[model samples]
Structures are given as structure tokens and as C-alpha cells.
Target: ENKAMESRLRQAGFPYVRTLEDFDFAFQAAISKRHIQQLTTMQWIDDAFNVFFLGPPGTGKTHLSVAIGGAAVDKGYKVRFISMDQLVSAFRTESTDPKAHRALRAIRKADLVIIDELGFLPITRTEANQFFQLVNDLYQRTSIIITSNKSFEEW
Candidate 1:
């Protein structure tokens, strides 16, 4: 059972395997290790609360988000990690296409999804609408960890 679970996690398509232990709190002093530890417990996921990691480049926002998502996966929850570009590309590829449906279905089924680099790419208003639709669909049903370089005010 343990082996199978490991295999499942391996195939879950994490951007990269990042763990809380691997994160360098010394380098990123602004981030609170205690907060990260609390997040690792994934209580937010149980309550379907979204986690937003907003910081400038090289601040380790991605590291924290991935670490948290990895924690969820380790606890036997399904997780999917993708960049903002990949998400927009998937949505812009033809709304009724099989690929789009597959992406939506995958997000729907995941217990936690890590959307990394959420403002790195330029998306059209239409694509933004579609993305919001996905967010709306997942609201209160699945948890998401969003890593963005932009602040909430910018968003």
C-alpha cells in the first residue's frame, strides 16, 4: 500500500518535489517558518481555504507553495501543479476541445492544486474569464495554492 501510494504521488505531476525541510528559511527571512509549518498541516485544505503566496522574484514563494502542496500529496491527497502560462494555454486551446475538458476535469478532481507563477504570463480578458470560471467551480470544493509575483492590490 505504501509503495502504491508513493507511485501515485510520483505520477501526480508536481512542478518539482519541494519539501518544507528543503526550504531555506535563513535565506528568506521574511517568510515565517512557523506559518509554513502550520500550513504543512493542511488544515486550510480541509476547510477549502485558498493560500496565496505573493512576493517579488527570488523570495521563495514557489518554494513554499510547492512544499505545502507536496505535504498534501504526502498525506494521500491528490494534487496537481501547473504554471500560469500552462493554465492559460490550456484554456485558450479551444474551449470545447478534449484537452480543455481534461484540464478542467483534472483540476476538479484534485484535492489541492498549486498554480505557480500566476502573473508571469499575459492572458486575454477572455482567458481570464475562463480562469475565473474554473476558480468559481473549485471554490469551497477544492483548495488551491497560488504563487504570484504581483500583490493583491495589483490583482
Candidate 2:
């Protein structure tokens, strides 16, 4: 079990490790601790529900998403953490890049995917189409958690 967890954590691709216990709820008082506790249960992932964390930069969006993703990994779910830029880049070169192809394949097989830093960069039409197709394919199959600094209207 330890080895499996180590492998899963390594495969999850988190920039760094962060756990719920390390989160400063008092600093981000707007977030409800109880609600976050509920999320740590990971029932939403099991239901293939998508989670969105939208706020200005440095409001703990990535931190919360990473914490929840870490929890998911600990629970034995396959998880993948990719920045939005990285994902878009992978989509752009997936056809010719073996590394990108492998990354996409790993994402598809993950039970929970954490996409951080959405809306940080503008994407071309081709990239948008590729992203749409990937999301459509993951729909109803894998759960996704996205962290974006932009509002829903802006997106």
C-alpha cells in the first residue's frame, strides 16, 4: 500500500505536496471549513462532478485544489495535476509529441484530474478545439478540478 501510494503521488504531478491540515482556514475565512471537510470525502469525484475554484490570484485556489487532490490520491484514486498551460501545450503537440501523447493518456486514465491556472493565458482556436474534445471525452468518466483566476463570464 505504501509503494502504491508513493507511485500514485509521484504520478499525480503536483508541483509540491500540500495537505488539508496545512491549509490556513482562518486566513481565508470566506471559505467554509465544514464544506471543505465535506469535499475531502471525495464523493464528488466518484460522481464525476467537476469542481471549479475561481478567485483572484493568491486566494488559495490552487492550494485548496492541491489539498483536495492530495486527499484523493491518499484514498487510492488515480490523480493527475497539470497546469492549464501545460495541458494546452500538450494538446497542441499531442499528434507529434510522444511525451504529450503519454501525458494525455495518463490524464484519461486518472480518476481525478486537477487543472491549475486556467485563464492565465489566451489560447488559439485550434487549441480551444482540442481542449473541448478532451473535456468532452472525459465527461461522465473522469472528475476534474479546475482553478481559474477569471470569472465564469470572462471564460
Candidate 3:
């Protein structure tokens, strides 16, 4: 009975959710009255922000990333979910052709981008630059959620 009730409550607030616990922590962290008061007083507003979820595996990094993306989608923002491998593979495949530019534009135009599994394998210098370019393009234009298993030193 308790589980069913919780499910209904989550569905009421988040209709398109894949998992009810996805935004659990973020919602809690953001809704605290103390933090809300502090945020209201802040003057500077940036065009975009990067959220890095650095932790060991099975720590809900990707889950929270997806949840944030879902919230953005619900609010009418364009969102994209691409793993590091997929992004690099696609970029490399288009590297020698005119389509490379188009691939970059897609990443740039997204309002929210969820990049999962960073530092999964060794990346070549060329691949690293391509990743950096994508990051640069979205630096101040769109929000980014990056999930990484490795520590900052590895990056």
C-alpha cells in the first residue's frame, strides 16, 4: 500500500519519469527553504552551468542526469542523451566529411545535454580535442550533465 501511494505521488508530479527516485536528491536539495532564500539573493546569473557527477559506479549519477534532462524536457527544453563512446564514435565517423559540422551543430543547439560514462577507455589526442570542442561550443550556451567514474585527476 505504501509503495503504491508513493508511486501515485511521483506520477502526479513527474508524469514522464522512467524511475521515481531519479530526482529524489536534487529535489530535496533544491527545495530546502534555506537554499531557496540564498538563491533568491544571488545577483549574478550565468547563461549556462555544468554539473559534474563524480562518484563511484552505481551511485545514481546517470539516473540524476536523466532526471534533470526530463525536467528540462517537461519545461519545453530540447535535450540529448549521448554516451561518451557514442559521441566520439559519431564524431570520428563524420570527421572527414561535411557532416562533421552538422554533428557539432546538433550538440550545440541542444538546451540540455547528458553525457554519460566519461573516462571509460583511453581516448586519443584527436578524440580529446573533439570532445573539448563540443564542450567549448556548449560552454555558455546550454546546460551539461557529465557522469564520470574517474576522479578529477584522470580527466
- Model 3 TM-score is 0.69
lDDT, candidate 3, 1-155, per-residue tens: 55654543343233244433433555455334453233222121134767677778766667666665654555455667778887788788775766655655666787667788999877899999989988987877787778899998988
lDDT of 1 at 68: 80
List candidate 3 stretches off by more than 4 Å: 1-46, 95-103
Considering only N, C-alpha and C atoms within 3 Å, which residue pairs clash in candidate 3? none
> In angstroms, what RMSD does candidate 2 have relative to the true structure?
0.8
What's the ranking of the predictions by lDDT, best on top? 2, 1, 3
Best of the candidates, TM-score: 2
Tell me, by lDDT, which candidate is best.
2
* Candidate 1 deviation (Cα RMSD): 1.6
Model 1: per-residue Cα lDDT at residue 86? 81
Per-residue accuracy of model 1 over 1-155 as CA lDDT, tens digit each: 78867875775667677788988899988888998899878889999999899989999888787778777877888888888888887887645688766866787888898888988777889888988998998999899889999988877
lDDT of each residue in 1-155, candidate 2, tens digit only: 99999999999999998888888999999988999899988899999999998899988998898899989999999999999899998987889999999999999999999999888999888888888888898999899999999999988
> Which residues of candidate 1, in runs, are more than 4 Å off?
94-100
Summing lDDT over every window of 10 consecutive residues in candidate 3, give the lowest-scoring window.
36-45
